[model samples]
Target: MSELSIFSYLPADDPEVLEQLQDRIELVRHKLKFVELVPTVACISSLSPLKLAGGLVPELIRLAGGTPVELEDLAAADPQYIIVALEGSPLNTAMSEVETLMALPGWESLDAVKNGRIYLADGEGHFSDSPAGIVETIEMIGEILNPKQFAFGYEGEGWIKFGV
Candidate 1:
């Protein structure tokens, strides 16, 4: 048992923590009330290799109030939202990646692509492999999914629109 485990770090047994968590949950729920329905989201890590969602990626999408689905599902039915995660900063490369993905067959048919719901995630210290990146990632995803509620720019915050 590592002392640094999430089980030990979480304040699961603390009533105050629970109350605070509940409050935040309620706030998020209230903010999303006008959303009507959550969209199905697909996360793509790469275009050439065709890497798809797994691990924290799906969890982040869920926290953002979108249903995470596999890339294969995109072929069967298009997802309403798409998140493309880049390796690092220098948005030129990220934009190129998005262009490459859009060039793929059937990609243009996706509702997300047509509706401008496609996004790119890349920034220094914004998206990290460490667990500490979860909060920022969730926030970024929330802003992307519901800009009306989480209104914020993504340019310097590790996220950005594919062309905008």
Candidate 2:
């Protein structure tokens, strides 16, 4: 199994918090261990179980072009894309929150993950102030996924294609 990079901001010092975290981690590890090959797209998010299980989860199934193991079930889980789905303001607005998640044990230690591909999936459309905002968002994901494949520019009217 490759390194597991977890995205979370749950405090680690508290006993109750630690126990819960350990339990969740164990579950995730167990699940990830079942997968056998690299998945096309892995939707990594901290969304509520209901929202993730009901919505994003299914979309990811289709996006992956093959079966995708839950974040917990990934065995060789050196994540290629760390997709962050946030509501309200852009994820950049919550820099501290992002940093906290990055500081989590698994994420902080993963040296292989290239930086800045950190995605800010803003469904609230808060960045509509800039007509090219969607393109910028897509560019960020592209950069994080593969800098060589995507050019950093707005393709008129927020059209974007990240080398997925």
Candidate that would win on lDDT: 1
Return the TM-score for each candidate structure.
0.72, 0.39
Model 2 gets an lDDT of: 0.38
Candidate 2 lands at a TM-score of 0.39
Question: All candidates' lDDT scores?
Answer: 0.65, 0.38
For model 2, residues 1-164, the per-residue Cα lDDT tens digits are: 11121212234457685466555434433443454443344444444331222233323233222233354432245444444444444444433355544554466333233433334444344222232332234343343344344444423222222221
> Relative to the unseen true structure, what is the Cα RMSD of model 1?
5.1
Q: Kindly report which residue stretches of model 2 are placed more than 4 angstroms away from their true locations once superposed.
A: 1-42, 47-54, 57-69, 73-76, 111-117, 121-123, 126-164
Clash tally for model 2: 6
Off by over 4 Å in 1: 1-30, 87-90, 123-129, 152-156
